[model samples]
Target: MNRTLIITGKGKVSATPDIVYIRFPILVNDVHYATAVKGLDGIVASLRNCITTNGINKNELKTSDFRVNTQTKWNDNTKEYEFSKFEAHHDLLLQLPFDTELINNTTNDIVKLERNIEFQISFGVKDSTIYKQLLIENAISDAKKSAAIIAHASDIKLKEILNINYSFSEITFRSDLNYSYDSCLMETNEKIMPDLNPDAIDVNESITITWRIEN
Candidate 1:
């Protein structure tokens, strides 16, 4: 006669993000192409100055993108194409230690200079070693609990762990609120909370283990 048992377990763990990455896009528009470009350049200069003057590390600032485009309009009365406007867009990327207060302060200053700016912030684990260690410990604990439960149900005693299988879990990156015109307007000048909520992020891992049983 042969006896077999199967069990499943789940492990959950949460961590606060240590690092933040943000991308800001500033858009400048005017009827004149050169004027729009100049405005965008000035805004960029102001951003750099603000960062440097505020004591941000120089290495943390980087130019992610720059572009200029022209829009045209057709006149209904005169069957002619009219130069509508020109737009200059610049994207700036920044990396820093997670500090909500500092970020909020910096954003308030930036928005005062330019109204047509949008931002996206990403949070993640800075050290791979810490993440791996936490995940492995949680997985093992979950496996042990599952093995114990199975052993008790089958009227047996768990003798030893035969095998362990682990797969890397994906790191979830998301924002508290979706970015929209109305949301962005409300965020300006609003005091950002100093401590971010861990519930805003979800971190999980799974482990499969085989244990020997004695009956």
Candidate 2:
């Protein structure tokens, strides 16, 4: 009978993000759908112009999501929900390199456009191909090393790998500072700057290897 040795390995890789993503919300409300959409268009045009002045191409502004919904409100006389208006939202985004000067300049320009406007900033890597490759390599190496050690201790020989499986854990990144409109509108006397440091983003992966051993 052939015996098998199964070993699992864990790998973690860390890297600083090379890119920045900012999400801007453009909201409009009106009694008619067409009017609501028209209001959104006006805001979109203004946002495009704002980013273009900061050396960003107008095309770089992407629409993450756009949708219209009917809202309701309560009336004092009826004491029941009534139709409020149509609300349209355009979630716009911008991708920029991790440059301090560019970030400072671009965000400053965006804040001046409107006081109630809300935005979010997140740091991320441009390409995760290299990190993924490295993670797999490390996992494989770790499995081999562990299997070899166990086999040697047991006085057994490992001949061939019979199976290899990788877990489905997704790779994701997190941001340190996420700005909202209300918090951003604080008095200028008490100022807070967003963290510029590109914190280390960790990529973790695991693999299991089964090796056939001499009986």
- Candidate 2, 89-161: lDDT as tens digits: 9999889988878877777666666534567788888887788888889988988999889998999999999
TM-score (all chains, Cα) for each model: 0.64, 0.87
* lDDT (C-alpha, whole model) for all candidates: 0.68, 0.81
How well does candidate 1 match the true structure in TM-score terms?
0.64
Error of 2 at 169 (Å): 5.3
Decoy 2 TM-score against native: 0.87
> What digit string (tens of lDDT, one per residue) describes model 1 on residues 1-215?
33444454566666656777777777888998889988887877777776766578756778899899888899998999988898788888887776777766666666555444566766765665665677678777877887787788878987666667777756454434322223365555654334444344445677787776679
Candidate 1 has an lDDT of 0.68
Q: Pick the TM-score winner.
A: 2
Q: Please list the residue runs of candidate 2 whose C-alpha ends up more than 4 Å from where it truly belongs after superposition.
A: 74-80, 167-170, 173-184, 187-195
